[model samples]
Target: MYYQCFFFLQIDRQFLRISTVPLLSTFFAELDRYSPRLMEIFSRKGRQAGKEITQIMDAISKDDTIHTRRACVIKSLCTYLNEDPEKLVKAYLDSDFELQSTMEQTVMGVYVILIEGALPDDDPADIAVLIEGVEVLSDLNSIAQACALLFGLIYCLNLSYPQQLKCT
Candidate 1:
């Protein structure tokens, strides 16, 4: 019985390897055909557009009002995901007292929290991205970078977005 099981497993592995080659080749062929058009649509002056976008994002990230709005948005997203909004992220004033008090309330899951000062002119002190209560990234320079990283992670991990998000 053990030998038969081992033989079937080997045959399955070989079959998978043989079948995957054609699929991979076809996928790459399609990619090659479309890559130039994609580059044309997404690139400008050979990456100058990307730099300009990054600059704009950095400026937006520095705005205190935007940070406040983003915190609210995060809470809303948590609610949409059927998660506890309070557990998603907790914004705190960039003060030692507040930080010490709030540190104890951290929860598990993927989330981001912004620490900023009270003044409108003050930039965020920190932006942290956590997974399962462990910090994966912190003090990201711009919202764009953080977003790109999260998107890349989702793609690499083969995660599916929520149905509502996917429909949009």
Candidate 2:
């Protein structure tokens, strides 16, 4: 049954891709024709955000650079949560951070774990998404992929975002 469900999911996802390609292409072509300046601004902003995210990720994945450069990244991450960077860093390093877990009780919700190497030459980091403290997905290739899956699970399960990260 699990295999059958997975097969259907794959088929559905492939069908979505097949059906949306031309629709998206036509939409974008029309938007470009209607407002070339708007399209250019969107393209430039997207490329700039992509480059910035890539730089931040690269810094985060490198243990040495992280020590010196993670301030901006950490601040950006915690901005929506209204969290203190020092405490968050400590909790993250100790593997004690949970999205919805507190000292008194653990809330039932999805959480993401990103494990990076201690050394610069080490292998790439691994990402995991858990629910109710149980890992549901592991060894995801990237934070983006893990986050995408996390959002998908939240939507599919009809779960609310964590309180602190509600704005995110």
Candidate 3:
């Protein structure tokens, strides 16, 4: 977990320092907890990290919402780390992270977990679990709850809301 945080910190620095695009400025600023050592590691591995950061920036191009943009960033970072989003999600569910009591609440919990990439572990499984969980959450009665789930899925998949809105 410590190393994972460090890794993100370095990536955050690289994104902020080199990229001319300021789309993620606010997002990166929120990660100030990571120290300068992480920035040093990023400097040392400039070639590789540079390529990954470029990919991340490209991913953010299609997103309008911060939720969706951050999701793309996480997905790109996962690729850089040789990790899969689905596997990371499953591992998060299996860990001791706190979950809500009801199934609906639990679905919301999982939605938040996957969207945030809060877990730092590996477990392989079909991504269907995540899809199903989000679908279930989307079916709940409250409009607010349903919207939250929908936004969570959009973020998870890095979907363009404007494009989808046009399609609908």
Can you write out model 1's per-residue Cα lDDT over 1-168, one digit (the tens) per residue? 111111222323443465543332343355446544543443342254444323423433566354343333333333434454445344555545655334544432233343543454455666554433445556654333343333333344455643333421
Candidate 3, residues 43-92: lDDT per residue as tens digits? 34446655665654463355444444444444444444544432322222
Backbone clash total for model 2 is 0
| lDDT of the candidates, in the order given | 0.41, 0.40, 0.36
**Which segments of candidate 1 are over 4 A away from where they belong?**
1-74, 80-82, 96-117, 142-148, 154-168
Q: Which runs in model 2 stand beyond 4 Å of their true positions?
A: 1-117
Assess every candidate by TM-score: 0.36, 0.42, 0.27
Ranking by TM-score: 2, 1, 3
TM-score of 2: 0.42
The residue-by-residue lDDT of candidate 2 on 49-156, one tens digit each, is 544434534654555342223233433344323443222222122254553354224332223233443444343344455554555655554333444455555555
Please report how far candidate 3 places residue 47 from its true position, in Å.
Answer: 5.0
The candidate maximizing TM-score is 2
- What local lDDT does model 1 show for residue 27? 34
Cα lDDT, model 2, residue 168 = 46
